[model samples]
Target: MIDPILPFSSYSEEINSMLPETIQKELVFLIDSDFMDWKKIESILKKFPSISHSIVRRRLDVDFGRLSRRLTGKSIGVALSGGGAKGFAHLGLLKCFEENEIPVDMISGTSAGAIMGGLFAMGLDSSDILPLIRNFWLDRNLLGDFTFPFVSLVRGKRYSQAIHEFFKDRSIETLPIPFYAIACNLTKAERKVFDRGLLWKAVRSSTSIPGIFPPFAERGELFVDGGLLDNLPGSILKERGAGILISVDLGGGGQIDKDEMYHNLLGPHYLGEAPSFFNLLFHHLKRKL
Candidate 1:
């Protein structure tokens, strides 16, 4: 069981004694950050302390091992970019990482990238996600639904339900791995990072497109796709002390399709003084086309 609001001091004595000072400090920091799972923290402590305690007897140098890597801040962070359907490539990327034995220590994502990243963070492998995509995400009836088109083309109820079904209302902080989902607050006119909340809601909020899907209302603020603000969210990982950063920008400049042009001006929110750089570029290319 995970402690939602407990600080490091409230943990059991066994766990507290098993952890190193660095890890104890990190646990406090993570609790303050509001985005960590105690199980993952405990696992790290359990795995590393044994090695640290027996390194001398095992003829392994403490200066050049897992403990050294942890102390030196050599954690690997991968930032997944929003690209709609193109974001599915993130699963392949993760599979490749697993194949090459590259473990991801942290993750940040926007829009569709959040969906893939969230699943990975929840301990689902790429192979597991493939069937999910085929059975749920690729369902034409769910995604291709049309409504009266008030705020968006689709009502977004089904999409939201789909996300909830996939994640099963799991809390973001309870995941086995660290993850962040980026969203754009329409009411605040700023970017939002979801470190703690229902995992499905964060994924849904991040994937909400202004014209395609209705915005998610939370705390009196409307939130849409993070792609509208910070599409590639590697900066968050860097802020958290990740030494190596791998950012995948799948939503970069490309040929504007007919579907993309049709949904460009469905609302005033899509056209403002400070529009997204990619959105602005998409509009410019639409006129030329």
Candidate 2:
């Protein structure tokens, strides 16, 4: 499974408990992000000595050849990607896996993690799109590059506006940013404030980007919608009948407004904050399998 191991989320124990003993014997690589304390992960690995580890980070500079060798004889490769630079890096790894003929079952936590697990992976800049869409005009080596006229028209608009226009009839709304800050501050007093809906109002008022906006706002929304329903990219993982499981952190206000896209990245604060969603996904997998 392509499990983006966030700094806070740990699924190793759950995975170990769920898999049958016989199937566990064949599991090969337990690839995770270096952000995870190696000591903690190593301790967990000790329980299942048969599973090997591959820690990925920016400094390591992993390539497809290295990955191919790692998975040559393996039945399953549990890959992880999370955090800032790590999100883009994780997409690079996923691209590598697609190239190497490895079947992937992906799990993502926050926005960065979730988007990479999506069908049309989102990127930080145009440069990130090159690897996925090699034949697009953007990828063709252009002489005297001229900025697209559309870029100038949408410069000052909010992310939700850009996405709404792209989707035509689809409606989208931006998530309130104040809600995120309140969620981050985990205190009984803070919780009470949010419960009163003050946090949502604050986020709606305070968060504003002058010239910047989210890339692939519509694509991200589509993924969150379709990925949850297992509609888009239905052909990619056809053998499973259903696609991958998605669990969004409710602490991040998992309040997806229809036809609206939040400007900032969405995610959970710390781990275990969205246990209900996790439990729901677990039960769904149990029934599907």
> What range of 10 consecutive residues in model 1 has the weakest lDDT sum?
51-60
Error of 2 at 61 (Å): 31
Residue pairs in candidate 1 whose N, alpha carbon or C atoms collide under 3 angstroms: none
Report the number of the highest-TM-score candidate.
Answer: 1
Q: Give the lDDT of residue 153 in candidate 2.
A: 22
Per-residue lDDT of candidate 1, residues 10-42 (tens digit): 554645576676763333222333444445544
lDDT of 2 by residue, 47-162 (tens): 65665343323332332333344445322322222232234554566566557854442222233333343322111223454444343223343222333434222332343432
| Cα misplacement distance, residue 269 of candidate 1 (Å) | 18
lDDT of each: 0.69, 0.29
Candidate 1: misplaced stretches above 4 Å?
1-24, 28-71, 253-289
Clashes of each: 0, 9
Worst lDDT 10-window in candidate 2: 170-179
Looking at candidate 2, what is the lDDT of residue 264?
Answer: 25
